[model samples]
Target chain A: MSVTMDKPPVADGAPRPYTLRQPRLPRWTPPALALGAAAVAVGIGIGAGLGSRIQWGLIAGLLFVVGMYALAARVEGRRQAKDRLATSLVWVCFLLAVVPLISLVWETVARGSKVLDGGFLSHSMSGVLTIQPGGGVYHAIIGTLEQVGIATAISAPIGLLTAIYLVEYGRGRLAKAVTFFVDVMTGIPSIVAGLFILSFWIIMLDFGYSGFAGSMALSILMMPVVVRSTEEMLKLVPNELREASLALGVPKWRTILKVVLPTAIGGIATGVMLAVARIAGETAPIVLLVFGSQVINNNPFDGAQSSLPYYIYEQWAAGNEASYDRAWAAALVLIAFVMILNLVARGIARWKAPKTGR
Target chain B: MDITPATSAAPPPLSGAPAPAEQAKSATRPGDRIFLGFSRGSGILLLVIMAAIAAFLAVRAVNALSHNEGNFFTTFEWSANSTPPVFGIAVLAFGTVVSSLIAMLIAVPVAIGVALFVSHYAPRKLATPLSYVIDLLAAVPSIVYGLWGALFLVPHLGGLYSWLNDYLGWTGIFAYHDGAARSLFTIGILLAIMILPIVTSVSREVFLQTPRMNEEAALALGATRWEVIRMSVLPFGRSGVISASMLGLGRALGETMAVATVLSPSFLINTSLLDPGGGTFAQNIASSFKESGEIGKDALIASGLVLFVLTLLVNGAARMIIARRKEYTA
Candidate 1:
């Protein structure tokens, strides 16, 4: 073992000079480069009279990436340099996305908080002029509630049944076609649905504008969402449960009704509510179909009606400071309503997830 | 319910079913028959609705198109309510496509990065809440975004537009004339923000689903984290990312209130994106609905048909990609 090879590569070496560890930049290198890049960007911005902080930030981001690549390449290797480039880009992307979203929420809350009050909530824009401040979303809220309620009532059962058919009984070409069309249905723009109802309900049948027409369109939008979500939940039900019920001489329909549905009921309710939340904020279809009214219209089947979203739109279109305040306030209420529904839907999913055992 | 049972019973006697079929059918009770019929009918009803939407829209669109004094595809002016009812979709098509193109250009790469950040880069503690925030962002309704865009984003974008014009005005697209910052470009940015969450969520799911073994093998070869992702994750999720972007594009094309709120509608197509004038199909429809006559309403319906078909193609292609990817993975 100790026999000396005269031409050994490591001649006269105590231990090969090579080390397993590569020469790595210090951990502080990234932050240091970022700070230097920021300084340079600020300098360039001031010198060039840049108007937007966005431009400065973009320059700083670019400089940081370039600097990081150059530094890492020199100290470590090209691979590490590329990795640093990717890391920086990903971080920048996250920051870019976060900015607009935060601004949206913050602006809505800040501007909207100015006019939102009990009086604003309880009164209607019935007698008030478009440019004045004295009005509320009371009628709009009622219209939205009734229209959305009817939409849910119409769509939920049909959507649920469609899902049940797809998951439980779907087999051949008809099922496949239904599935494909349902996917396509989910992509129908709200306005197209409105146009469909408009042509059919008003143009063909000669009915005037009513909230019922809007509800029909909203139901069209809600149906596909409900079907998709409900189908997923239904597919999660255990086959063995159905088998066990069938073995006990329970009819197949009864097995589905009494055994399978109860198991998935929590998820089904959540899906329907989420669908409701989705349609509740739709404004485009309502503008065409409902023919928004300033005063209360309790009967959705009657003349023109306004919903919360339509109210915000109508107010904003009025183009006055007072109208803008009302729009913002209504927007705040709408957002709050939507956010609560989302939270509750997710909460229900979390709470019921354990019982499903998947 | 009783009517359904009666109809089912009526069908059985005429078919003259075979023995095993009859036995099997009898084993299933009337309740099963009715339930099956009802659920199946519901599925058929959905198909019928889709067909009706297409058919009815076509009928109205054709009626409007026939009466038009101007070329439906080429003419720029829209005076559908006027005598002879001249209207066309040239400007609306340009605005819709250009705005959505800008939206796709900005949104797709950023969405992928956000997806990667959530799936790989972020700390575990940060990732959960970050995605939650994104989900909330998606749930924030479009009208709220419109309000924010008009009041907050439109005002704030003046500086950025000027900066862009200063550097890139020679390109003509970025040229700004110091007008209100409610151009198609502004709507593009707003649409990008709106579609970001959906794109991110879809891409994140695909990225997360990349096989653990492939990633681990790359890492075992002394690959850095980013290298591992580039080698193992991105290739697998490429189609997913494409489909996600297409889905986002579908959304951007049909988006109504946000664009309607932000863009100052005019019938002319602007060479510079920084200009305040131009219209989208959906936006034109919404803005003109109030002032139009019956012919105008039909003309708006005609425009909606174009949006509907365009979105359908985009979404259909996206779904095909997803379906193909599913087969490959399975």
Candidate 2:
């Protein structure tokens, strides 16, 4: 390389300079090209009388990618152009995915805010007619809370114990079988879980529709999520901690109960709460099991109940403008509720992250 | 002796603590025995629940299948309450498969692109927040998506649907007759959007775990950025992406509210997706549950049993792929 630079290279009959320099586009090239593509796309869209700005945007994006690749290849060679093309496509993909998400949130909040007020939150739908406007999700809120609370109560302990069995005491075929079936159980659809309870509790045993039945189905869905998350958290508790406790002559049970549980409690709680958040939004199971009611049913064990998600479905099915507004409001409440749980769960995870200093 | 250390850690032993005779067995102390039993019982209980779900669904499905006057697999109408009840899953099965197929086709490529962008293309500051947003988006409930799809998306999709019909109507699948945009095609798009976040996050994780040395070696060899990714990253992440897509497909197949809310259910199978006349199993069960009698409920359960088995197969395939990939990596 030094010899080539010092003395010019002789190619065929001509002498040429041997320098390590390649032609490259300026940093502003992409943005400038994109602006040109947008202008051209908009001009064509206006001339052709395209109905949607989305069509124009798609045209602009396509032009930008093609134009960038052509100009880059001319100046900077094939490899650099290919790289730029890939980067631009990735950006396009990112924008495409993000736009709908933002729209979904923005639409929900904008429309949901119209009917979401104190009265809307406090009253039940019992007195309100399906075609008439004013109603609230108070009954649904009560039903969701009770049903989800009961589900959490039933599943959290069993899930925790199952996770403990897998992590702490698991050995041989039983443990392996438990682990395999847990993975299988995780994939059971919420509707299928409801169907299971439907066949068993409602049909076979001749029981009436109740939120308690919904809770049973929910626990089925919740259990696997809980077990998976808790198992991960428990695994994060270093084996050294367990060994340390056991080396002190502490019994195995005491070591697990005192040392391990305390160490992982924050993570365990976070997992449980996240699982609750997941099951709380479930509508399919509740639709089949709780058998949604219009009035507030305080007793989850005795009668049919409504939930936030179920209310949304029911209101939407009513298919009127007023019912549509109520559905939006309920959806807003459900999103906010689930988001809060998620934020708090993540916060707990961070606050109580194991300080093993690994 | 073990009891002594454990009890000594506290100020006082409880009155219900096991007697000395029971505690004398060091390995089989009453506390250990009971805890083991309790935890093991919980594990066994989970297995039982899984078994019970399959057993109950299968039994009911069989019972319903036996009483059908029409061929259960061939009949198109779902009237379980009629005399000599006859209902079949031909249309439901067709609708479910086609809608989920459409969803998978649209979602998988876009998800891989988003995953690649988050893992490799975006700057660190941008990548972190972008991925966090994706994570939160995944947690957004499907019912919310269903509502949004019904109210917002259906109305807005008119132009695009017309555009597709105009350009691709020669293909029978894209034909449209100026009907409401509540169709299997629309449901497919909604399901795609709903499952995108999950597929993207999983693939992003796999892309992030691509061995750094492999990537750097390609880079050091003067390969372009895209070449480096193509040679080292995509190959390593291929199985991961496949499994991620399978997971998304499983979700799309079993999704209820979004399809139920978006698609106008009809018992007949339609050749054109743009026509609002196809019904999925989950959607059928959901929309039909309200008015169904005992026999109707039993029929819904039978359809749900099919859905359960379908998801199980998809999920099982995904798990197998993941398990195989693990062995390769290890």
Candidate 3:
């Protein structure tokens, strides 16, 4: 029987039929592919066995999935599966680390919100008992304001001037020494700052526990932060501005005051506020310096004044449910204040960032 | 204009003399020079403040030393209230070092892992939010950490402590006592958690700065993703990791509230990690300052001086390492 074949018509002296070719495999391909796949599977099996406990199960599962991918790739193609597995593993690790942080914030807000009320803000622990839960952090808040405010007042100008001198007028041996000391101070433990202030002011000078002592402790901690931040900000003020002011025959100090500082004021303010925030939640130094008090002490130089940190410690350590509730509320308040300060600092920085384009 | 022209006369310098107007403008006034001098004097004021802090600390520390009765370095006992006072920072120093080392051991690996995960592995959309969460952790006050450790972690760690004791009892470091509620291990763990965010943030930034070309080349060579990270990103960020670790160490060494809350104070030094004793320098100061006698306060001050020196040395080393890396980069 004659069968009709669909074939190309010859343009020249060529055959009209087409030929089918056989697909040939390389001799080493199967064994190499099998070995790689086996190795991956064995590794994953071992990992899975070792990682049966904890979240290691997740890792074991991932390794097994990768092994399966590798085996499948050996049949289809090698590169595509490897890429897919690696990408998947990366995502798993990212999510694993992210979960705890969200949980922590969520827990804090949920637990801390229960006691956050107006009554919690306006009164002190003076009237409330262990069972009753209506006291406020008025004394602690006031003390915190007074002590931290005094500390800022003491630290800001000194730190700013030091930074100004370092960036503007400093060049020689003394400047180097100042820089060295400032670096040392930056590393000094908050406890050491407290000890330094406590020893010098209280033991040596015979001044007892007070908000002033806390301020001194906070100042020691705050100064280094202020100096570092301010120095960075001042350094960022373009050198051309300095030269311009100099060319105008303005005095160096006047140029710094009128031109340089004014230009960098936004950054300087932000830095100062950041420094304040950095020290506001410090508990160690204040614990050492300030005495806990239920009643607010108006004057910083008086005896036994309570700060927010001290208040938290006192309330929590008291071991009463009511006091514990108050402590949580106070913590919430402190955290909110610090958050606000940080936001403000960020805003100032964004607002004052030098305009580059028209 | 016409009146001015009528009154105008030639004001010219004669053969070898200068006009009074020229002389008046030629030299700077002494007052101006004095003002310049005063302005320079402000720099001196800065120096003075710096010197004053150091000087004040030194004097107080010296006073503490002179009044102190026992060998401040070797003696483990801290009996500051006795008439013939016998106390030392040996216990405190040991606690500080041990806790900080424990913290570093826990924090370093986790921090690097997290940093690597975020910078190299995390998707673009997830990275920012993850970093913001870390920032929030950093912003949470130390006292909050203290409360969390005290209320939640301490109670739960008992099981873990027993497990450590059962499995790792041969090693003195992991040995456990009955009371696991207030122990150095808990303090160390809390400190690790507290410093984790700082190290992760800094190291993440550093890892992010790794040269993309090198990473791409490694990947192009058929290297695994982790292999590329090991070969390119880690080497690039080693100095930064070291710096970040030091910063974390600095915080861990000085951390007060968390340690204070987690630990139960004891005078004697115990090697067991789960023992509810061993006070850190900050904890000692915080716990004792209110009730301490004058000599006791001085003793605390003396220990604080040691911590100060230790931290200074640590940060100085970190700065030097960072500076050397900058030089290499330059």
Per candidate, native contacts kept equal: 0.77, 0.72, 0.38
TM-score for each model: 0.93, 0.93, 0.81
Model 3 quality (TM-score): 0.81
lDDT of 1 by residue, B116-171 (tens): 99999999999999998898788888988898899888887888898888899999
DockQ score of candidate 2? 0.63
Reference contact recovery of candidate 1: 0.77
What TM-score does chain A of each model score against the native chain A?
Answer: 0.91, 0.93, 0.77
Residue by residue across A115-233, what tens digits does model 3's lDDT show? 98887788887856756778788888898899999999988877887787788877889777777667667766777777767767876688778999989878878887788888888
lDDT of 2 by residue, B90-172 (tens): 99999999999999998998899999999999999999989988988988998999999999888877767788889999999
User: Model 2 chain A: which ten-residue window has the lowest total lDDT?
Assistant: A4-13
Q: Give per-residue CA lDDT, model 1, range A17-81, as digits (tens).
A: 65545567898987888899999999998998886777788899899888888887776666777
The global Cα lDDT (0 to 1) of model 2 is 0.90
TM-score of chain A of 1: 0.91
Residues B249-285, candidate 3: write the lDDT tens digits.
9888888888887789887789787878889988988
DockQ of each: 0.65, 0.63, 0.28
